[model samples]
Target: MKLLALQGFLLIIAVEMVAVLVHQQHIMLWAAGVAVAVPLAGLRRLLTTGDAGSADGVPIIDEPGAALRQWLSGTEARIRWSESTRADWDRRWRPTLAGRFEVSSGQGRVKDPAAFAATGVMLFGDALWPWVDPGNVAPAGEDGPGPGRAVLEEILRRLEQR
Candidate 1:
């Protein structure tokens, strides 16, 4: 910008000098104004226009991972909410975890209910089976704290292994 301003200043000086010599001391305010206006307009455009090749701005490349981020955010919220209350554990965390565990013994998809339970038990063990059993939802009026972060983290770790 400094270089551009310098060049513009030189341009204006050259134009004014030419006008003086050609017009014989007869000042053409209109011609001087034109010269001044051109550079100022260019400067304004340079100031406003973004660079085509610059990498200084925030990137616009988040689109591809936007859905993943959204899902992770929602899941994180659910985890926090579920950990906050027993109702949320049964309503949100358990159901989601159970839903996430619907796989066959071989880690393939499973549709049968018995097979789902068996697979879940095999993967998460008898202790965790109730917590992530699709057929289970805590009875109403069951309100207290759920398994906290440590348990949740363990469940997630176990789940991720498969």
Candidate 2:
């Protein structure tokens, strides 16, 4: 919105400048045409490139953990935090040091633990980190959606924050 306003201001200034500097009628007309054309291009770009979050419906998980698990299955992992967590990553989550994100795999490490765990939280939420431990921030209650869908929404919110 700010960008569009700035472009409008600039277009007004340019049109004024062109009208003042270009005395001949033909040159002035050409300049005006170019000025309008430039701003139209900018407007087109602004309208086309919009926020991806403004979609119509909420992002629902049809198959619960299975979809995310399958996505992770194809992911490449450089390190495995635990064989157990890796084994149950789909149904029940056990946090580990390393995790493979949606597309790229094996990129996370001990230093950047979020690289792997962030996606896991999005996929499994409370299952990934039980209430018994600390640093658990999963959503509460069953008001809006089921556990799987709620976790999926949480994941989307987390991704948008990034």
Candidate 3:
């Protein structure tokens, strides 16, 4: 609204300046007509613009999954994977991943680490599973889409796929 007023004011000022600079009466009339027509066209466009909202008054791309995907991708870059901090990652992210979607870790003792690893791989993919093993650390600088971020992204993709 303020922009429209400002533009109208500027157009009027320009028309007046042009009128003052030129003595010819016909050019002055043409200048005034142009100034009025331009603002009227702009006003028509503004008034005719359609509502972006649906009947529910909601917008597309506003889902929780979109936000989660962005967060997971951003977090991947900040994580500096190191051999010394294996326990920290396990304690921090394991429960987070499990509790995030409210999935149970299943019953009793986890007898087979490979099967457990496979389950994590299936859910989160190979990017996260190797980190579960004490010996496996993702090679440094492999945090691009094919690995680190790709791991969590695969999970988000599957979730959104539903």
Candidate 4:
């Protein structure tokens, strides 16, 4: 995504340079317009539809009010949320709607200690998991019992019982 953006920007610059070299103000204006419009169109699409993932290059988790449940019998996954970290995964991936979604680490391998240890070293070195929603606009407040809050509560309850 970053590469694409860079390439588009370069193309725009190239177009402007060519226009300047030939003294074609009209053509230069058109090129400039296209250069701006193309990226803006892409940005609009991203904002309207919330599917932004770097690896996949598309929105991964797209369901509204969606909750991801990962059962890690051996090792845990790391998660991060937009509201807490302010990392803006969405913006980095999709500039229009950059900070609208969450990203998380996948359930890693943990069947064997030696092998798991090697992989675990890499996994643990990465970011945190279960990047939950920041409970934005929850009438109950940040810690109040909203939908996401309820889900977290249930998960905690289940973990405690286990």
Candidate 5:
């Protein structure tokens, strides 16, 4: 605002000086009117039109990009997880699975380790409970091969259904 005021004032002074030399002092009034009105008019248009590329006001999100990126990242991680060993599952995926079960439980609150274990048991039932049991955070007794892709897919399906 200070700069705009200075510019308008300077324009008025210049116009007035030129007007005096040309013996037409009325030109100063025209200069002052143009300086004030032109800026205000531009401001009005700018405010009403909003973003240049999106004249409707709000900017749009790339939903497909976001969804696809997330899916790809998760798929890539799951591929690695499937290729890992029992010890790796205990170290990595177990906590993630336990967290999901706990969050999906009726309590909807962060809880103690015991509560997380109970939630995992209840959600996964007997068959898969061993996979994500919170009490099973200790290193696996064996570095045996992981259950692989089909098992992981079944686990995902079961989780989604639950």
Candidate 6:
């Protein structure tokens, strides 16, 4: 993530430098436009691209990416535990699961460990919710499976049905 941010920054700087070298005010404006547009485009893609299924219905888990598939599987397994309380849930679970996933699947380590772990925990929470509270219902935005929780929920549902 840091590398991506740095690369984006550098790309912006490069565009600005080129605009300056050309002495084009319009080009500078164009550079500024790109500077604003690229990240927003990325953000949009991030926000829109993830799973978008409702918790009331079955979630789709058709991700073709092997690493992502494994991550989803690991997330589902971690959440099925009922004996462990949230306070007692181990923080190391994410990294440990991710590591094992990396090894078994031959996928590389997550780029951002903290972010990955945090996401894993969120996924775990979502998956465990149905088991923890059968009557509990997810809210509108909260119910849809998206890149963050959605993908995990979908995978968990699939696993549970299996």
TM-score of each: 0.49, 0.27, 0.31, 0.36, 0.47, 0.30
Report residue 88 deviation for candidate 6 (angstroms). Answer: 27
For model 4, the stretches where C-alpha displacement exceeds 4 angstroms are 1-5, 54-58, 62-72, 75-162
Query: In model 5, which range of ten residues has the least summed lDDT?
Result: 51-60
Q: Taking the tens digit of each residue's C-alpha lDDT, what string does model 2 give over 1-162? A: 566568777886778687777666566677767777787777777578643322443434357889788778654231121222323333233122122233333434354556545654554455633321123423443223223434434443543454
For model 5, state the Cα shift of residue 98 in Å. 0.5
Task: Give the higher-TM-score candidate: 2 or 4.
Answer: 4
- Summarize candidate 1's per-residue lDDT along 1-162 as a digit string, tens digits: 676688788888888888888975556676678778888988787677643333564434547889999999987887697578777888778767866776424443344667666777888888877777756776788887787877788788898988
Model 1 residue runs over 4 Å out of place are 1-76, 103-110
Over 4 Å off in model 3, which ranges?
51-162
| Pairwise lDDT winner, candidates 1 and 3 | 1
Best-first order by lDDT = 1, 5, 3, 6, 2, 4
Q: What lDDT would candidate 3 get against the real structure?
A: 0.55
Model 4, C-alpha of 20: deviation from truth (Å): 2.3
Give the Cα lDDT of each candidate.
0.74, 0.46, 0.55, 0.43, 0.68, 0.50
Q: Please give the lDDT score for candidate 6.
A: 0.50
Against the true structure, whose TM-score is highest?
Answer: 1
Give the candidates in order of TM-score, highest first: 1, 5, 4, 3, 6, 2
Which is better, 2 or 4, measured by lDDT? 2
lDDT of 3 by residue, 23-43 (tens): 666678778888888888877
lDDT of 2 at 5: 68
The pairs that clash in candidate 1 are none
